[model samples]
Target chain A: MSRPLLVILLSIAGAGSIVLALVVGTYPISVLQVIETIVAPAPGVVHDVVWQLRAPRVLAAFACGGLLALAGALLQVLLRNALADPYVLGVSGGAALGALVAMLLGAGDTGVSFLALAGALGSIVVVFGLTFRGGDWNVYRLLLTGVVLSAGLSACVSLILVLAPQAQVKGMLFWLMGDLAYAGSPVYAWLILAVLTALAVAQGIRLDLLAAGELKALSLGVAVTPLKLAVFFGAALATAAAVTLGGAIGFVGLMAAHAVRLLGVSHHRALLPLAVLLGGSLITLADTAARTAWAPQQLPVGVLIALVGVPAMLWLLGRRN
Target chain B: MPGVLSCRHLRLQVPGRMLCGDVSVTFEPGQMWAILGRNGCGKTTLVHALAGLDRAAGAAVELDGVVLANTPRRRRARDVGVLLQQEETEFWGSVLDYVLLGRFPHADSWTGFSREDETRATQALETVELAPLSARRYVSLSGGERQRARIAQLLAQDPRAFLLDEPLQHLDLQHQARVLARFQQLVRDERRLVAMVLHDALWPGRYCTHALLIYDGGALASGASREVLTRANLERLYAAPLAEVSYDGGSYFVPHV
Candidate 1:
């Protein structure tokens, strides 16, 4: 497919998934009713259900998915490792630990979000400090440090879970599984997603060169250190924002990037945007399935993402092989 | 002052091993220079240091009499292009798209690839004789095809000096001659300096105007090829006895064993 056509198709798919998510909840609102709820506001239960409840949740899912996938793509290029994802560097683990600590302290949603971002930033700094030496960024050291740090953070999370009261443990588990009930407003996440996507697209060509290897990028006159720093921070910020909004969602970050590449979107300019669109659509569809698959008993979107993403990724790899 | 690329008090070392020490060389335009040395004798390391891809603490490389460290990376890239010894096999894209990356230093913006850039890339592919594989995935190409594709990328770069490490690594004899001849032609017609690290002594003797022999723990002998590539120098550089035979008014070194 041509680039523009693929972009248009992805956009349509994204919009269609969002609409389907908004309409396919337990209340079973028609498409006309969904449109009516947005266009003409009525002071009724339908308005309360769609506008007050479902809209923010659906938009949050879309924004979080886009953020995760964009971060995944940037890290994959920065590290030149195909297995890299948003959480590969332990950013999500730090966020989860921070959110859990806040939850244990009886903090509100905003407090938890702020702490999660802080935790994610802290993890980035630690990983960078530990892995960087003598002006060289060793990929193996960085990968190992991040993975070990993530394991340490997971222990902290498990400790928090074991110590928390029984009543709060269920809520904590749901949040860990990426429950979107507490994603109050999608505005902040969408703003972050837009800004980071713009930045990534702006540096897309450099990302391509970096993927070829650091030596190749340097020889080609790319400011390798500065570009790597930008990608590192950009991906960290995006991952933090996504985890804050949607908890520690998995699969979308890792799989969406590979899926777009498998579909023949090679250049980062097209790859980044299409990855975002595909990621957003995947989570929105998964979230819709999570909510309505067993109505009134919502499954975490992370579970559904893994269920869907694993098979899709396996098929992609299988076909490529 | 005599050459476009010159280094002073050059030194390269890794941990306990010294690759090159106190080596100074000047490379002028309109010359094809070859660096010859045995395996692990720092030939690749020396080329990388000259290209500013690796700079030790005291080593200073100057391009056109300006300090290479002071030049911005993008501007330096406009003047010098280095083709690495090993090509990364993990990159995913069309061969043309990969070559178009050479236009990166000239690109106006991050997201833009101009018409002129595409023309240069296409012309480069044609020059390397891989125009038919322009749309093929880079990872799918054979070793020789990939080497040619990279040569195309360097040609598209069109830098003032080309520093290539093992430019003929994977190519068969025919392609090897073809690529080296292209570099030789570039030096002759365009006055661009082409310096490559070569394992074979025969091709450098045939195609190079100047040669640098690295031997015996950071010792270097450099001058015109006919003066520096003597049979004795070749023996010391490789640590093997060589039989020099003149063929077609040129010398070729063959191991005596």
Candidate 2:
């Protein structure tokens, strides 16, 4: 009975996203008009502006946001630490390093994507390599190693920024901040497909099995090494894809997962998929705020996540305590 | 229905010190046995080696007449239950969930809790009289309740043999009586083997079918519990006199004050 209640509430919340997205700009469009614009046509620039400019961006926001949140949830379980975030395990630092090097080399957008991905993959592998004991990596050790690796990668990034040409630094700076501007149809299609696939794999009570101690889980016949590898690789690939598209939009992963738990649900089977959807929605909301909070000069969408997510997470963890 | 387990030429050491080496022992099934030793005398170290939870030198731990590999012996874990001291606080789960972990060696990946699994888990909890507190968080359990839950988990495992380290640790007089009574019933009714490490000499003499006394990393004596648990031997083990006392249908020993 209670399970069904969460499902229904989520459906209603899904409908609300359209209204919230359409109604929030300067020269705001009404929900009725936005619906009509979708169904029919306004015949001029509003049609192009609404459909072309805002709609694609909204979907992209949700996609990347949800991806980050799901990644956070998975990493938390795989690492066996409740405080784990998507970027905490050096995943983000590696991506940033990849994107920065690519930019400096003048490898445009595709190069940016590939390098960021390579960085994320490398960092995840490195953390796993350094910390693995027996068939598993202890979360506390992984976290410590990650924090150290991330700091090292970050320092390298700063060194590159200092040494690089001015033009390269500007491009690197933007990629580091992750804007929702360039994400159009092709990026959205590829990104959403990969994310949904990873989400489908991560969603289940099997995730609860990760909460079981390693010895107990092993005794239960869990192929522990392969399971950890699957989770780690899946979450890392999805996260790298997000960084490839959205940059280092901090706290979306942390907030989205934390928010769902704060809403009085702890079961990962329910929390994960919802975290994906709610994560997407939250990032979309942050993107919306980033757009509307200033007229033309825009804030990095990552800033809005920090602003909203910090208080929200603290409140959630506090309330739980 | 007796199962034979024998260890031969076993050795364990750390750097310049030898904890236990060139030692051999065996116990037949359907009998209760006790291992007694001094502090840092390799009692726990020996328990871990015998349970296959730790590696040993020059010996292999065999179960049911087969020499199982260390990794695959986890499959054999369903037959051997162990209650290491203070294992609960290191992890999180409910009392019910903690006991349910006993059934894991039978499970595969899916985390499925079948009806039979729950039934066995419930029966085990009932044996320890912890059924009413099944829903309580594991951390919230009292010292006695935690001990009861651990024993219930061991019972639920339906192990062929039980290997327990400090099995009577962290219980008051009343709770200790309850646990020991259950232990006695298990040995008498089920006629299964139990190898437990006991700090107290009285319980072993009253409950154990066989006893082995160890001090300074060597066996002092071992035989039928009554013969092995004598005051003279206890005095030798503890290096002091112990006042032996007789109480209602049971015998106890204490310091003469």
- The candidate that wins on TM-score is 1
Looking only at chain B, model 1 earns a TM-score of 0.95
lDDT tens digits, residue span A1-321, model 2? 255686677656655674577667777677777878888986876677677778777777777887788889888778776677888888889999998898888886777777887998899889878988776566678789999999999999999999999867766776678676645443653465465554544434355545555544443334556767777777777787788677888887766766776574555657777777677777778888888889677767887878887887787778732
Ten contiguous residues with the weakest lDDT in model 1 chain A: A312-321
Top-DockQ structure, candidate number: 1
TM-scores vs. true structure, each candidate? 0.96, 0.81
- Judged by whole-model lDDT over C-alpha atoms, candidate 1 comes out at 0.88
TM-score of predicted chain A against the true chain A, for each candidate: 0.94, 0.84
- RMSD to the hidden true structure, all candidates: 2.0, 4.5
Per-residue lDDT over B1-257 for candidate 1, one digit per residue giving the tens place of the 0 to 100 score: 12399888887676788777777899999999999888888888778887888856323889888888778888878889999998553779899999999988888765488999999999999988899999999988998899999999988988889999999988999989988989999899889999999999789899999999888788889999999999989988888898887999888888888
**CA shift of A153, model 2, Å:** 1.2
lDDT of 1 by residue, A158-195 (tens): 99999998878887887888877678688988999999
Residue A176 deviation, candidate 1, in Å? 1.8
